[model samples]
Target: DLDGDGDCEILYGSSDGKVYVMDHLGQELSGWPQSSKADLQGRYGFVVSPSVGDIDGDGALEIVCGTLAGHLYAWELDGSVISGFPQYVGRSAKSVCAVVDIDDADDAAEIIVHGGKSELWAMKGNGTALSGYPLELGGDEDEFDSWIFASSPIVLDLELDGSLQIAVGSTSGEVYVFNTDGSVVDGWPVATGDWVYSTVTPVDLDGDYEPEIVVASADGKVHAWNAAGEVVAGFPVTLDAPVYGSVAAADMTGDGANELVVASSSGAVYMINKDGNFMSGWPTSPSATTFASPIIIDVNNDGALDVVLGAQNSALQAWSRNGELILSQVHEAGDWIDGTAVASDIDKDGLVELVFGAYDGKVYVIDLDTPATDANLAWPAFRGDRVRGADAVSTDSDQDELPDAFEMAQFNGLEQSGADDFDLDGVSNANEWIAGTNAASASDFFSVQLSYLPGEPSASRRVRLTWNGVAGRCYTSWQCGQLDEGEEWELADPESGTIDCESTGEMSHEFDVSADDCFFRISVTR
Candidate 1:
């Protein structure tokens, strides 16, 4: 998936402090198996799953993960570390990171994570901390003992408003909802009366259009709260065992209403209705224990959704919508399956594959026999999607590397050609898309300026070149000694190769003036 080669490539970090990318045939990708110990001095290795997205607005996805050593790292697809990364968060980062577009104006998304004990960290794509972030919690003694531990954060429009909010749980038994600006949503930080290790799942349990925030506690209770932080009418439902994984939702009965799916530590899976009652054939156990979250999909190509889950017993279970076990579809693994499964048509072969990581140090990709359908089912994957963004997957109908959603939103259709300039701004539609510049405005293209450095010695005269750039994009400069026709151009700084932008701002570089007739030009390398 990282190379867009039609076959899905698996990305995972191991206990040995190495992150790897493997193709579908299990061959390692070039420049992979990047070691955190060598790269960031990471001693504790990666304890949480990695998140992928185009964090830098450079049109290519970047992988982001936090080590248990409390250092967050970002790497390009080619195994190179992003500049200014390996940012220290706190004592440790036990939670999964969420990469999302918290601010629409920025185009580049933000990385949100619970930085160990009592701080929620938010950083821009360029590895710089977002303003008013790394928000501290648990200030009052009566509030709680500790804040977020292993629970991942979710970004969604909880109020049914246009703006998104961050929702996460604390080990102290409270669910906090914060606006993009780090301000607490009115009436949030609701008490669940027990420790919460599960990520908050948003589902419209009552057909109200507004999703109800659902979460389970370690004390074997499920709680659903409305937008106003009020408990749902049916109230908290008690389960037989402690819940360690997040709850999932889907229309299991094809009744058009979502049923909450909960997997307990004892491996008991329950389907609960909105009325706080268990559905028929309830509490089915697939294995001895389970700490991984469950996902819903049409595994048999049936119109009704099916349950797919992983367990500590090294088994991946598939159950029908009516609670019947699909014995033939069950897959056994080499070790404990503690990570939630994600489904995607990675091969583009009209069928989806279920992917997950196991304690045996292997990432498994299971091909489901079901044909690919519109993945509109509730809670189809961990934290909602492969990137853990809690948003619908963006499609690229024209396969131009530009998402259809983005193209439609920005240009009204797919009529714009990737290699052609839409606004006659000297930049192609593709480059404009990568730079996050306006495609219809001729004045909004990438621009560069040249000037002489003020403090340079006359004998070593230097010229400074500054250009507006997007973070993570590589820019290369070319120079020609003469302006005559067919004159050869060479790299302005041959030893530097390409310059990687560290932030979406004016980036400057100085070159020793080689000739009075030198002409220079800057272009994006990637």
Candidate 2:
């Protein structure tokens, strides 16, 4: 939860252009119901879901979401707008934004989202566009055949190379896989023969370590493709209706193999085994129509996974792994639940709770008797996790202190040593990593400056020390009577143990000048 109180807080965006945060008891948190209409200076609301993560390296989480008017906003836990946010991307942002560490140099995450039409944007946590991004998917904007991206993008290490690859679908019926550099991966942009509205789900079906891509389309088919982009045998399984939402995978049968859970717009929920065959007692209809993806969890503490999904009939339904309806578990909402539901042990209690938002501008948190451990079930929530729409894989392949993605982006490979100063900057790569500064830019190194306030009581003059700081990085200001070699450096403000940099900018600390000659310095800490 935002306050680290152990009870999960429900965060959601409504059609009225407001974002809200509420406690588990359904009480609205203070400084919430943030209005996008006022923030963006227009009438707009969220059509896609909101994602939460520490956009900055700060330990505190920030809410990231886009509006139908095409502005992307980032807010602090208290509903305060982050500096450099409400970035205008395009005409509309209809897909969920994926917050991930695409760049590992600073340990900060990037916000990846479809900027409507042919644009795909990669924005840094500071709300600035990442270089080489906002890549045009369909080429020239004037082309009449340009594709529109509606499906949310997923990030994964498809090749198990420690670097993430982005996979997303378009209205042109094609699924694209791209390297972090924005180059299309070989054997990708594969045609699906119909519009793809579902985000690609990655599952290691053959125990190959690398995940296989599984996605459904308006063609009424579920297509499976290996890492090589070749269609898996048993082929595109045809269904009775088109799939509009994403597919969820989990070990529903406890056979150590994942079962694909699909909820179609026709209100049917089907479970297909890894063999591309439908499970027994399949195709259970929970409601008349459903645009929400199903989540697999043990809702009744029955030792077996249950499929949970919301429907246009304003009801949340649950069914056993074998497709039998959980008769006593239906929960109705005031309006349609078009978005996917997330499960967690919200109240720090042993039981898990299902949380989702509805068209009536209300968020519901339904408690269940299931064990809290069920929250860790494989693919328990939408997009495989509760924080983001996709998973970001980061690793140090060569045992270096720097991440593989950082080395690859800066040196084209892992050829540079973390102990060396790559750009001839005074700071080593390791220190640069800690300071979240650019190792390749000498001018970007961290340092501090001291200055005296313009006006203050002559008896105890005030002095301020400012430093270039990174968000989430802790710093300590020190002072010493003299610059002697053995002089001890004590905390400038002992009462305040450490200073937390809330944002990447000038971080300063002020204190009354000492009665005698003193020296001041700033040191960066973890």
Q: What are the per-residue Cα lDDT tens digits for candidate 2 across 1-526?
A: 7887777777777778888888889888888978885334454878776777678988777888887777889998888999999988776676788777787767677899976665779988888888888877662231321322368887777765456788888776788888888988999888887888788888767533247899999878898999779998775888888888888887776555667889878988999988899999898854678778899888888777888889988988889988998988888999998888888877878778888888887777887877766233445566766332223442343446665435533554456777989988778987776777777788888888889888855666678898887875899888877988898888888887699988778778988767563688877764
lDDT of 1 at 364: 78
Whole-model Cα lDDT of every candidate shown, in order: 0.75, 0.76
**True lDDT of residue 80, candidate 2:** 91
Candidate 1 residue 380 C-alpha distance from true site, Å: 3.2
Model 1, 1-526: lDDT tens per residue? 6787767677776767777878777889888977774323335677667777778888777888887667788898898999888888876676788878787766677888887655789898878888898887552221221333467888777753346788888767889999989999998999886778899887778753357889999899999998889999886999988888999876677555778888988988898999889998877954578888889887777666788899988988888866888888788899998878878766778777778888887777887777655442334577655332223222232446454333544564456667878789898887786665777789898777999767745555678889787765788888877889999888888888689977778788888766454688877743
For each candidate, give its TM-score against the true structure: 0.71, 0.71
Candidate 1, overall lDDT? 0.75
Instruction: Give the runs in model 2 whose Cα sits over 4 Å from its true position.
Output: 38-43, 139-149, 374-376, 386-526
